[model samples]
Target: MATFSLLVTANPHSSQGQFSAIQFAKTLISQGHILKRVFFYADGVLVASRLNCPPSDEYNLTKTWAKLAIEHDFELVACVTVAMKRGITNAAEAERNALTGDNLDPAFEISGLGQLTEAMLESDRLVTFG
Candidate 1:
């Protein structure tokens, strides 16, 4: 089975990119392929925000991605610089930066772009959804 890395570069709510990434990951897993990593960059960092509460009738892509990461043991990483710039802060960063509270979900980690590069190097395929 091919090992895949998904690079997300769009907002979850604004476009279909985030949903597409999630679906692709799920399909790959179902087909017995491995999802090695999910790298959130640019506006895609919003997927890690715990503050994202989609309406009851709407599909919550953030939660979906988080669950998938936890269930399948895929590395869920967000670019620290991009996340901070977009106001998406994890517990540690929030405390260090004296932010109001932790807005990032625990399912994802704030990391550098090197993780993305590593995923690309390690995985058999690097697919981008944006």
Candidate 2:
């Protein structure tokens, strides 16, 4: 199985892009593939927001991603710049920006663009969902 670096650039709940990405990632892992990172960029930053609360009967994309990341031991990295622009700050960023709260999910991390570059370099395949 090959190593993959998945990039997601769609809103988690508004469309099927995020759902497809998650399903593909699961398939890869189930098939014995290695996922290096799941990078959230553009509108995809919404996938990492801790404040995302879908309807009771709906599937929670953020929670699904979190559980998969933990279960698979893969990195779920949200683009720091995009996340900040969308107000999806973690504790450190919120403190630096003087925000009253932070909402980035604990399952994911905020990182620079270099991490994305490195993921591509290390991965055998780069998959994008946008």
**What is candidate 2's lDDT per residue for 1-130, written digit by digit as tens?**
8999999998876788999999999999999999989999999998898889989899999999999999999999999999999989999999999999999999999999998999999999999999
| Candidate 1: tens digits of C-alpha lDDT, residues 1-130 | 9999999998887899988888889999999999999999999998889889989999987788888889999988999998998899987898988998788888989999999999999999999998
What is the lDDT of every predicted structure here? 0.91, 0.94
- The reply for model 2, stretches above 4 Å from the true place, is none
Clash-forming residue pairs, model 1: none
Q: How many residue pairs clash in each candidate?
A: 0, 0
Q: Which stretches of candidate 1 lie over 4 Å from their true place?
A: none
lDDT of residue 116 for candidate 1: 96
Model 1, 73: alpha-carbon shift in Å? 1.0
What TM-score do all the candidates reach, one by one? 0.96, 0.98
Any idea how many clashes model 2 has?
0
